[model samples]
Target: MSLGTVSQAGLLLALVAAATLSGCGQQTLDNSQDVAAALATGGGSSSPQATERELPTFDCNALGERASSIEMLICQEPELAKLDQQLAEVYAKAGDKAVNEQPPLLKAEQRGWIKGRNECWKSEDKLQCTRDSYQRRIVELQARYHLVASTGPVFFACDGNPANELVTTFFETEPATMIAERGDRSILMFSVPSGSGAKYQGGDYSFWEHQGEARVTWGYGAEEMLCKPTTQDDK
Candidate 1:
């Protein structure tokens, strides 16, 4: 996640451009990967030497004379470039699973996500911000699209009421994640460092599990509910 020093001024401008593009609702180009591959291949040469050189999934050269600050960073940083490639592969798999859906939900969401990732320049720790942005997005796509192995639709009765239950499925993502569904609502939470037990938080929900019990708060400012796993296998 560590990136070398970069100019803050450049990043600020990049953030502005990213936000503007996002607001304008830019559509993702379908042939972007092809274009990138061509660039990596040195004008479609595709020699073994050219293929040996690792490049970002997107066209770093396509940025042309005046590249965005974020783009420049990704091009220069191997770690970031590797992450970009990983995300591209995962995204492609997810897209295949979601191909039948109307309106192409995955494509639209990916466009928005790219904008959000570019906006990471606003953070004081810009490198960490960018890295976290990629990691979280990868975990999200994996969980949402079920691209990884998973465990449990484990049920938990909350507040001593069997009817008031939470159903959770854990995914084997990098940071580990769980989707908790109650009624018609579902929240995807990522694991966080905890002193005593596993803790996950996302959106308006927070869940902590210790032993066979859990404490959960489903919404902002809501009372925490004590829960016990009702499923023996999960316990």
Candidate 2:
């Protein structure tokens, strides 16, 4: 072959090699674009799973057009919604314990409680009332069901008479709580700020304990009873 012909053949082979590289580069560019598009659209199986978010116990969006003001308020307020979720969880646990009971007491009580909660609208500060209602109910269910740890059935002899006695049990609830029982009567009280000792107040009842002695009043306008802790031997 002539030198020119040989040179022409070599140039053709080089040109073919360049075309092949160009095609490969175009394919690589397309593949890179595909990966980017998949990432941007969150489309590929290899993409990380989305972080899950918590939702309220009830469907906030399903409140519908005729939903009550209180219902709407609960749905709108994150704190109230969270409280509702907490209450539902606590109530479910209580219900599970009461499942074997004859009357389904927990279920009935929950229905009544819901009615009472709705009555918060009558108060001047509905939000505060509702919040208080939820907190109290949660604490009550927790204590009543033994869902939380408690510190006593500690006995207190009122006015130095063992016959006139009050039974007290303190529970580890949010803000803490105590149930004071005298005869058939029981009052649930919440912890309050006190300059000295520990104090709890609920409705018309107030109990204050310092050292081993307690001053308790059971009724409205009732005289305070100075009580001392008693053991089984004292009873």
Candidate 3:
């Protein structure tokens, strides 16, 4: 959860962008293994423990009596309801930390995120997609706001693509693994201390480097790419 020496202006801009931006790139997480493996290895078994947590409750009444299938599912589905509560609690904490001209931006960004989450209704696996959206957003906000203490979230700028990049943000959970957010999905990668550099790997993608440039692979069929130091900040 180290903010490090990230510039104030840059940080603000990044926060705004992250808050508002939805997943425009391709999201290919059909396999449940992607999430399970990542969570299992991403430094913890599940979410950070929130004791006596006052889970947030969604207003299903707002949707009225006749709600969409997704809306109904969120209300009735146990897992989705649990995730919704977790998201609420984490979001409140993040909002508290998001002061100093950051609240409005975060609010607007959250609204956009809600819109993005609703887009999950179009996916074939509606439940899983919605769950992934909530989980990833919660983790991102928690890390960005330093809710839970952890290690390096070192950022890397890939060779070609502008939007395509890598971030290794660690959560203080269990098993001591790290989560790498690449593109529209996040993967769990275990850290390997190699010589002077470091390496992280999961199911589809991998990241490795010491000091200079690092190599990143998108998926099994993807080629390794040389990436330069972008910033230490997750934004």
Instruction: Judging by lDDT against the true structure, name the best candidate.
Output: 2
User: What's the true lDDT of residue 35 in model 1?
Assistant: 76
Clashing pairs in 3: 43-174, 43-177, 44-174, 197-210
**What's the lDDT for residue 131 in model 1?**
87
Better of 2 and 3 by TM-score: 2
TM-score, prediction 2: 0.72
Report the lDDT tens digits of candidate 1 across residue range 176-201: 99999988998999998999889999
CA RMSD for every model?
21.7, 8.4, 27.6
TM-score order of candidates, top first = 1, 2, 3
Candidate 1: which pairs clash? none
Task: Flag clash pairs in model 2.
Answer: none
Clash counts for all predictions:
0, 0, 4
lDDT of 3 by residue, 1-235 (tens): 3456557767888988876553322233434557667656653333323222222276765878666677677765667777888888888998898886533677887889888888888999998998878877776677666688887766777785545677767766322356777778877665556666767666677777757877888788998888876763534
Q: What tens-digit string does per-residue lDDT give for candidate 2 at 59-156?
A: 66787997667777776666677788899899989888887877667878888998888888788988898899899999999987789999999998
Q: Which ten contiguous residues of candidate 2 have the minimum total lDDT?
A: 46-55
**By summed lDDT, which 10 consecutive residues of candidate 1 come out lowest?**
45-54
